[model samples]
Target: MHELGIMTGVMESVETAARDAGATRVLEVRLTVGEMTEAIPDALEFAFEALSEQNELFDGAKLLITMVKPHSCCLACGAEFDHDRFHMFCPQCDSFALELLAGRELHIDSIEVDLPDD
Candidate 1:
């Protein structure tokens, strides 16, 4: 799955950070993903687990994901509202002309690691 590649990138980035900070091992990872990004949490978790088992630094690391719903503003009425995935329209003016304000993000929020001295 594409999630495997995504998870690999995430682990690589976090591992670099953890190593730079003198960490011996990663303990946890927190990520923020938007609905519009279409990254499945379950699949992401599976990928993470699979990668963790293959990596020495992330063998026991935990992954925590936070989902952000799509938020949009109607271009016609300038009204902001949550975008419904099924309808794909602005609720305020019922218009299809919308500017997405959020829900297209995928980033690491935080990482917990075991420092050499700790």
Candidate 2:
């Protein structure tokens, strides 16, 4: 699954940040998955668990994901509606020319790390 590669990249970035901050271990990684991203949260988590086996920093890290729904704005009637990739038309005026407001956001929201003691 594509989630494997995506999770790998995420973990890499998290690790880089953790290292820069002098962290010896990553405790948790929080992500926000938008409806339009087409990413499976469970699959990503599974991939993280599998891929992190060789990595000491993220070996036992927790992954938390939050799903965000797609939103659309109609240009014709200046209306907005919750949208999905399958149905992008505006609900209020049945307009096909709807601009997406929020969606397709696959980002790391927060990272918790254990810093090395001084």
Candidate 3:
């Protein structure tokens, strides 16, 4: 699954951030995933667990995932609506022309870290 690669990138970024911030350890990570992303939360969790074991920075760190629903705007009627992955049409105008406003995002929202005692 691509989740492994994605989680790898996430860990790298987190570690880099923690290092740059002079943090002793990473406590938690929150990721925002859109409906359009094929990455599964469970799969990502599995990857994170497997990959984070060797790194003390992420040891015992909690992984939190937030899922976002897809929203689109109808080009014809200029109407915005929430829709599922299977549909990409306007509800009001029933037109196939649609502009995706959301549901294609995959990024780290926030990271909790334990700073070194100054």
Candidate 4:
């Protein structure tokens, strides 16, 4: 699944950041994912677990995901509403002209790491 590739990239970035910050270990990773990306939560978690186990920095690290619903704005009626992936049409005017306001994001929000003590 594409989730593997996605997690691979995420792990690379996280590892680099943690090392650069002198982090001894990663505590948690918070990710914001949107429904439009179609990335399954379970798959992502599985991928994270598999990848994290390979790295010492990620031992016992927690992966927290925040799911974002699809939200769009109607270009015709200037109305905003939430919708599913299949239905993107504006509910107020029934127009197909819509601009997506959210639900297409796949990014790391924050990372909690244990830094070296002085």
| lDDT, candidate 4, 1-118, per-residue tens | 9999999999899999999999999999999999999999999999999998899999999999999999999999999999999998888999999999999999999999999999
Candidate 1 lDDT tens digits, 1-118: 7788888999999999999999999999999988887889999999999888888999788999999999888899999888646667876667899888989889999999998764
Query: Candidates' lDDT values, in order?
Result: 0.89, 0.89, 0.93, 0.96
Which model scores highest in TM-score?
A: 4
Q: Residue by residue across 1-118, what tens digits does model 2's lDDT show?
A: 8899889899989989999999999999999988787888899889989977979998678999998899988999999888777998888888898788888889999999999889
Worst 10 residues of 4 by lDDT: 84-93
TM-score of each: 0.94, 0.94, 0.95, 0.96
Candidate 3's residue-wise lDDT over 1-118, tens digit each? 8999999999999999999999999999999999888778899999999988989989999999998899999989999999989988898989999998999899999999999787
For candidate 4, report its TM-score: 0.96
What C-alpha lDDT does candidate 2 achieve relative to the native structure?
0.89
Consecutive 10-residue window with the lowest summed lDDT within model 1: 83-92
Q: What shift in Å separates residue 70 of candidate 4 from its native position after superposition?
A: 0.8
Give candidate 2 regions above 4 Å deviation: none
Q: Which residue ranges in model 3 land beyond 4 Å of their true spot?
A: none
Native-referenced Cα lDDT, model 4 = 0.96
| Candidate 4 displacement at residue 42 in angstroms | 0.8
